[model samples]
Target: MTAAVLSSPGATPPSKCFTIDKEYPKPTLPSQTWVLVKVKAAGLNRAELRGRNGDEPAPPEFGMFVDEFHPDPPKILGEEFVGIVEEAGSETKFTKGDHCTGFIYGGGKAFDGAYAEYVICPSQRCFKLPQTTLSWETLGATTMSMWTAHGSLFQAAQLTKGSTALIHGATSSVGVWATLLAKAQGCTVIATTRQSSKVDKLKSLGADHVLLEENLGDHLKKLAPKGVDCILELVGPDTLQTLALPHLAKHGSVVVTGVLTKQWAMKDFTPALIPPTRKMTFYSLEPGQEEDEGVEKVIEQVIGKVEAGTFKPEQFLDRTFSLEDVGQAHEYMEDSKAVGKVVVTVP
Candidate 1:
């Protein structure tokens, strides 16, 4: 087997090619546990970029229990996967040849990820895909980003019908999925982009309004005089100060997800001496950090909605690349020129 390795931390660790060089160690299958998935496609995430650049810390506590061990570059760099189950351990409902997708616990950190030909995962993280869910490319793309959006909007934020949400970077994979899901939940969605060009395009996807990032304050003041009910913050520190505290609606919440900006940048803010009547919150999708078991339950619910007409993965795939082109894919994502999700095909 061969996989991509991040040799060291820097800007973009050039996707160095490396042979698995030896037989993949057989994954331990305890009673009522484990499944062998022959991976078909794997998705690229900014987490992979950060891990490659050493921006992320070491694996968390659960890594030991899950056997998530890693050398310098990790066995490979990827997180979630969609594949066919070739084998299942005892006392498990899943059988041979189940088409499924799930979290790889500490993928891209402790163990090899879906970028390779095969992977082993706990059956708990895997879910059976509906007939409507075809193509490994689509499955690979959604599990992490889409699941994050679903969890943030509906669970963490407790979004409800008739609520309004401002999804920053609305054209990206998570942003686009959040916008659609918010709309499906009957909320008025306001999406934002630094580029004014995407404003109209965002509106076409049921965004009630699309505003420039620079004009976020003015637009919110005017359009949402009462203030937005929820905000999905993906741009990280750049937008944090302006989007927090007093700016939020009464009891409103913000989901802080990413920091896609120049490193070591400083932000300025004048702190409020008193807590605003409006509430504020922050969250990361880092595994083992979130306490909400509701997340998995909501994921299953969103998967059901995916089976229906509401969620669509096609909107998010900007382009596809061969595993050999993985470096180019990283370049595209880091440059921020590409819109939505950029996926890689292992074959």
Candidate 2:
């Protein structure tokens, strides 16, 4: 088995740390609740890139929670995958040939990941795909992005139809899905992008209004004079405090989903920054933490939308790389050249 391993820290160019192991051992089920998956395709995430490059610190308890643990510091590095079940433990309901798509709890941090021919994960973490005409590539790319979007909007923000939403970094995978999903729910969406070239693209994706991220306060104020009902703040804390907080409607919610600007915590952040009556919440889709928190329902809804020709995952796939080219996939995601998700296919 060949797996992409991250061994050392503080490596220059980041990609230097990604090494492919030709003889990596295949994983086996550690418990009756576990299942072995023959990976077909895997999705790359920015958090994994940051962890591999030492740009972000690995979770403190990483590699400490796997059922069948490996004693390696640098672990396998994929977060989401779509694959077929090769084996299922006796306690699990999954059959040997079930097609599944889901995320690992800690993935690259806790255990060997999906960047190999096989992956072992708890059976409950896998979501059985519905009978649809979608390809494996689309299903693989949908998990992390859609999970984040669905969780942030429906769970954290509690969005309702006809409400107004402001989404930053609207060209990101989660941003694109959030835009389409919010639109489908009848929300008037105001999406932002730093690149002017993406304005029309976002508009076509159903954003009611599109604005450049630079100096967006006045434009956002004018678009939603009464303030927005919900805000999907993906750009980070700076944008949240300076631009989003000021425009939150009474009882409105702002769900902080990503740190694309690389600033995790806000400087001088205080309760005074938020409106007296509004709410600000941080939403994270950690692999094990929220896997059962209505995720299957969201997955079913998203799949239904896709099957009904309402949501198109294919439109969000920018490129695909082979497992050997996992380093390049990480580079491409970090370069910000891609308009959507970058995926890697397993051999």
Candidate 3:
């Protein structure tokens, strides 16, 4: 296996390398726990860029097909990938040539990722993609964002039909998914973006209302006259306190998934108690967490919605890059200007 790995913390990874170098050992073969995938499409995520930039640590087992986990140096930097099954270890449901979309559970963060032509992934994390429907780019970007949005809305927050949802950073990857997912469930979707020019684009993507991030509070007040039923909170500390907590309607819930803000400090928690009452739910997409337990069901439902034209995932792709352009991909994420998901094409 030839693959790319984070050479050192803060160091640009060597453009390419073979899998059997002494530092990068061969993965366990013919095992039931892993499957070999011929990588077709890969999506760039914030975490991978962070690892490359030295903000997040890469573990020692990264370059190796299988090694111990590290948050930093030595780890591979891919998370979600779509591909054809080259081989399935025993205990896996997939057969050769099966189209699939999957996350590299602990592997990309702990070991070699999907930036290469082939990658190995845990059997449990993989899913057979919809036949003849989704493109490789769509499948690659679907998991983390869709699962995060779906789990937060339906599983954690229990957003129901006719609910009103205010989604912050509405044009980003997760925000777009949250908007569509909310609409599919019969909710009135409100999306927020700092760029005034993006308002119409958000509306076209199914958002019933679009507000500038600065005006979220006032926008919700006028739209509902009673407060919103749900909040999809993606921005960090600064925006969280004002837009999410206070604007929620009675019995309303807010789900926080990303920390896009620079500040980490938390101001005094002024719990909102409105005429109807409100609740807050913290959402993180990490595997093995209790919040992720029902993610698959939500993904299935969202996938169905996407296929039926009730929601659209392909519309969210703004740009696509190759595996060799990994650095540029990360730069795109860090720049924070993209309106949707940034995909990486793995040849």
How high is each candidate's TM-score? 0.81, 0.89, 0.80
Tens digit per residue, CA lDDT, model 2, 161-238: 989999888888889888888998899999999888778888988899999977799888887788999999988877
Arranged by TM-score, best first: 2, 1, 3
In terms of TM-score, which candidate is strongest?
2
Model 1 lDDT tens row, 232-308: 87776456665644356888887765556533222553446214665455544544443344544565566666666
Task: Write one digit per residue (lDDT tens) for candidate 3, span 93-121.
Answer: 78888887776645557656777777788
- Best-to-worst lDDT order: 2, 3, 1
Alpha-carbon local distance difference test for all models: 0.68, 0.79, 0.70
Could you tell me the lDDT of residue 339 within candidate 3? 74
Candidate 2 clashing pairs?
Answer: 105-287, 105-288
* Better model by lDDT: candidate 1 vs candidate 2: 2
